[model samples]
Target: MMSEWLVYPALGVIAGIFAGLLGVGGGVVIVPILLFVFTTQGFPAHHMMQMALATSLGSIVFTSIASFMTHHRHGAVRWDIVMGISPGILIGSFSGTWLAAQLSTRALKIFFACFLYYVASTMLRNFKPKPSRQLPGPLGMNGVGVVIGVISSLVGIGGGSLSVPFMMLCNVPVHHAIGTSAAIGFPIAVAGTLGYVVNGLSIADLPTPHLGYLYIPALFGIALFSFFSAPFGAKLSHKTPVVTLKRIFAVFLMIIATRILWGAL
Candidate 1:
């Protein structure tokens, strides 16, 4: 328990470092870390994944704020995209949490592992879809948001993996895509957090210092550092040479995903 104080903040630092730079790392890092810690600490096997997902989202609520605000200052965020997609994001994120709460832990782990693998491969290849058209109409944006929001809730991600690609496909620039994805993460986290909290309220014997699926101690630890560090990452995104670093991160995600898949299966 005491050691958790030291290590949980480390998770925050990692999350904050990547949140703005990649627009997606908060959940990618935090969910698996929390899942492992909770499993070792004798948290309910059946509920641990949901707890991890919820807590990660809660942390992202803060991290994404710092990240997107920084990106906005750099003139990288796409406000039109954020506004057009938010309605659907809210609906899909909330509903997806209900679906996640109903899923078995094994099912969730398998899905999340696969998603990680996909993200890794995409990052490794530096894949960006060729622009086919301009930004979509409101209805189209809403529909796209639904898919991204649903997947983000289920996988406990910031939706950058999905949204960034989609944005690039629609001719949005890379920095803008990443920044808009950060902005998009906020609503997804908010709706997903609420859904997980509401869904988990009736469950018994959860760990203390919890709000529904959120483990407050971990949330506090993560948020504290992530808030301060996220701006740094956002700044770096505007200036850093990240090709080599991105490859390294991609390989890291690959390793983590493979390990998770092994455990899940």
Candidate 2:
């Protein structure tokens, strides 16, 4: 138990660096680790997935703040896009959190596993935006934002996977889209974490050191390590070959998703 508590901070550091470098939600790394760690700690199997998902969202709140600030400082964020998508993200996050709470742990794990495979496949396809001559109007932007919000909220992602592609299709530069996506993560994390916490309030048998849906030790540890590590990851992103990184990340996701799916069955 004592050692498990110490591992949370280390998990945060690793997840934060990945989030910064890949612009992912951090759940990809956090969820698996939490599932393994919590299970080893003798938490009930029925509650393990729920706790993992909830704790992942809670930890994202901190990493998102750090990543968003870093991107904003670089002047890459598009405030207009962030504003346009916030309302939809807030609503979707709440709904998704509620939905997740209603599902069985096995079901949730299965869903997550499948979703991860989809993300990996999409990345491997090297999907690129079709050339567009015109910029998207307000209505078009709002529609895209809504879709991104709903999907991201449900999957515990930061919306980059969807938003970046949509922005590229709409004529936004890749760098700007990535930066804006990072900024958008802040609102998504905030709303999603709050929703998970509120929805989990009725779960009477959560493990020790937990508040609502969140594990305090995990949150504190992840926050402490990820905050500083995120900046470092962001720095590395600029130097690394993006194409190579993408392939590596895709492969990593594929392996994890396969393992998770097999475990669920």
Measured with C-alpha atoms, the lDDT of residue 147 in candidate 2 is: 66
> In candidate 1, what are the lDDT values of residues 113-216, reduced to their tens digit?
99999988888888889999988899998998898889999998778888988999899998899889889999999999999999999988899889898889
Clashes in predicted model 2: 0
- Name the regions of candidate 1 deviating beyond 4 angstroms: 20-23, 234-241
lDDT string for model 2 (3-84, tens) is 9768998898898888777666687788888888888888878777767877777777777776777678888888987887
| Steric clash pairs (candidate 2) | none
Candidate 1 matches the true fold with a TM-score of 0.94
- Best by lDDT, which number? 1
- For candidate 2, the per-residue lDDT at 129 reads 82
Q: Which 10-residue window of candidate 2 scores lowest in summed lDDT?
A: 133-142
Error of 1 at 36 (Å): 1.4
